[model samples]
Target: MTDLLETLIENREMVQPNHANMLEVAHGGNVMKWMDEVGAMSAMRFSGETCVTAQVNRMDFERPIPVGDTAYITAYVYDAGTSSVKVRLITEREDLRTREREKTTESYFVYVAIDDENRPTTVPKLTVDSETGERLRQDALEGEIDGNSDKS
Candidate 1:
């Protein structure tokens, strides 16, 4: 079994000019790519195998991340099937100085573990043992979170 918290992944990317759009904000594609990467990492951690994104569920972009700000991405495995890991991903626009974060994007991804033969492989079961892990999992399932100043 894999602990939900153990599969958690956190990453930050400096929104550079190359990653920004004409409005001087991070491009939606770039943000989605980053979120996918982080989600894949979480899936791989939980599955212990190479994971491929099988589906990207509902995704919403609520705000824009400025070029100079930091794009903070986080992912954790909330559920799993025989060969699939369901990951909850969130992206926040963070000010490195003040450490304030605003959620800009949110999505849920399903990744399938693959074996060396390029076939879907079985993955470990997921377990939520801690309060934070359970809360995060519930939020992902219920979609109860919103755009607020507080960062989870």
Candidate 2:
């Protein structure tokens, strides 16, 4: 079994000019690339094998990360099949100076574990042993934690 906690991944990137559009906000493509990188890392962490993106669920760009700000990304494996891993990904726009953050985008990705030969391979079952892990899993399933719900 792979603990959900073990699959958690976090990353931050500065929105540079090259990664932004004419409006100075990050381009959706760059943000998506970051999400895919983090999601693949989490899936590989859970499966202990190379993982490839199989599918990406609805990805909505909720806001913008202007240049000079930070893109905060997080990904975790919330579920897995025999050969596929389900990862929840979220991106947040943050002003590093003030430490203010707002959600930018959220998406779910499916990754398939691959063997050395590039063939799909079976992956272990997922487990949530800690309260934090459980809460995160629930948050993924529920879209976002409710304001009234207990948070980890």
Q: Highest TM-score among the candidates is held by which one? A: 1
RMSD (CA, Å), each prediction: 2.7, 3.3
The digit string of per-residue lDDT tens for model 1 on 1-152 reads 98999999999999999999999999999999999999999999999999999998877888999989999999999889999999888999999999999898888899999999989999998998999989988877776345332335
Instruction: Please provide TM-scores, in order, for all candidate models, with all chains considered together.
Output: 0.93, 0.92
Q: What is the C-alpha lDDT of each candidate?
A: 0.90, 0.90
Model 2 C-alpha lDDT per residue in residues 1-152, reported as the tens digit of each score: 98999999999999999999999999999999999999999999999999999998878787899999999999999988989999989899999999998888888899999999999999999999999999889888776433222222
What lDDT would candidate 2 get against the real structure?
0.90
Q: What is the TM-score (0 to 1) of candidate 2? A: 0.92
lDDT of 2 at 124: 97
In model 1, how large is the Cα lDDT of residue 3?
Answer: 94
Clashing pairs in 2: none
CA lDDT of 115 in candidate 2?
Answer: 97
lDDT of 2 at 127: 96
